[model samples]
Target: MDLTGKVAIVTGSGRGLGLAYARELAAAGAKVVVNDVDAATAEAAAKEITDAGGTAVAEVAAVGRTEAAEALVARAVDEFGRLDVLVTNAGVLRDKVLWKMSDDDFDTVIDVHLRGTFTCARAAVRRMREQGEGGRLILIGSPAGQRGNFGQTNYSAAKAGIVGFARTWAMELERANITVNAVIPVAATAMTETIPALKPYVDALRAGEPMPPFARTALAFGTPEDAAGLVAFLASDAASGVTGQAIGIGGDRLSLWSHPQQVVAAYADGGWRPGAIAEAWPTTVGAQLQTVGENLPEPPAA
Candidate 1:
């Protein structure tokens, strides 16, 4: 899709998935503001895009903070004249079991992943509304949030909260022609490296060796570039009709996730009582309750 004359701000674009998104958007003809906490990495990413004949500027600011988030959107407007796309991809991982997780760990994750998206979207949408041109708000989500992972209580909660933001904002912004969507990407970034089960595949990729079929599938699905195309598409005009949706992208796979809904309903003449609920629970909604772990089938051997 052509994004000529458009401007975009991508948080945490110094490396990995954010960088990929920034680069791809730039390649598609958008001026990009690359935001990251690290000055050097942000500058390097912006320079790389410029070197490749694309327009980009680096903004070294940590997201989640109100001032920082506002600054990022302002930078895009100040440099490029208008803000058209906002990609909230900045995140940090502080993994621990629910009981073992510290207050700082929980707060920090939520601040970066959830609050960062909220603040940035708020800042960008204001500009989009003032400019009287529709815009895109693309928030990053995770597989862990969709299907809970072990020892990621804080991370999972933060990622899951982002979906709620997208859904609500889509409704509020639709009248203005703005679209809000969440992307759950499986990419082989530093974040995915934390998973012990994926180490062998990551190692094989790094060493440039041929991997077994299963490992190859896993590695391909985790490639950062594989997710970038979807972000670029969402930023374009073609996706104007797509909003309030959680889209998944991994390698050759693209899927739409189902929204939360009631699976079964049981009603009484007046209201459900504790005793009545107890009697109907097993055969009603309770019957479909999934087992948390071990009951699921294992992956094929490599």
Candidate 2:
């Protein structure tokens, strides 16, 4: 659908990847609602879009709260008279292994990433259904959701939930002409920068060292604009036939099949266990360690 007269609400648009999406959508002629927890940041983002000759407005709201989600959606429809696109991109990271992860950490991540998506999508879907004009819901997910990562149990679970939520919503919204899809992106953003364990691996890769064999088929890093392009396409009518699917956008690596494909068979209750870990044996564990050792470059000595 042409966004010339449409409106879009992009959560977390105050900065980073969300900002990229907001800018792109606005440039495409959509009246963009830039939502962020920080009022100043949201205002700045909206101003940037306006400066670039695009229509935009700033809203400060905690997307994780249902009321805030509803208010944000209402603001879009109230200000622009209609809402056409809902991009649920707000996310936070609280990395910790299951053993060491606190209950709060797990709850916070799930609440913001998964529950926040639920709240926003729910509100938007209701409005879209009422208007009978259909709509687009683009969810931002991560590779961690596809393949479990160490020291990121909370994050992985939250991201995985987004994938499942999108797939289900796609089916429910199909008959209504509303399309739901997941945009799996791999950009170097604030979240990645805070991952200490990933630093060594990233540094090694930058130094020309080959990545691990089980590196989950990582795509080369791309600028935020690259991800924005994919989001724009997915939000457009060009992808009308594409629904209930997960489209991944990673530099040159579009397909991510680098994880142990048989992880499910090794699990007992659809969850990881110590015994299951033993069964992985020489194949999974060995492959991972070998890859890390082979690819990890030593730091410069003082």
Q: What is the lDDT of candidate 2?
A: 0.80
Residue 241: error of model 1 in Å? 0.7
Q: Write the per-residue lDDT of candidate 1 for residues 65-122, one digit (tens) a residue.
A: 9999889988888898999999999999998898998999999999999888889999
Clashes of each: 1, 1
C-alpha RMSD (angstroms) for model 2: 6.7
Stretches of candidate 1 off by over 4 Å are 210-220, 291-299
Candidate 1 lDDT (Cα, 0 to 1):
0.88
Give RMSD to native, each candidate: 2.0, 6.7
Tens digit of lDDT per residue, candidate 2, span 79-162?
999899999999888887678889899888888899999999999999999999889999998877876677888888888888
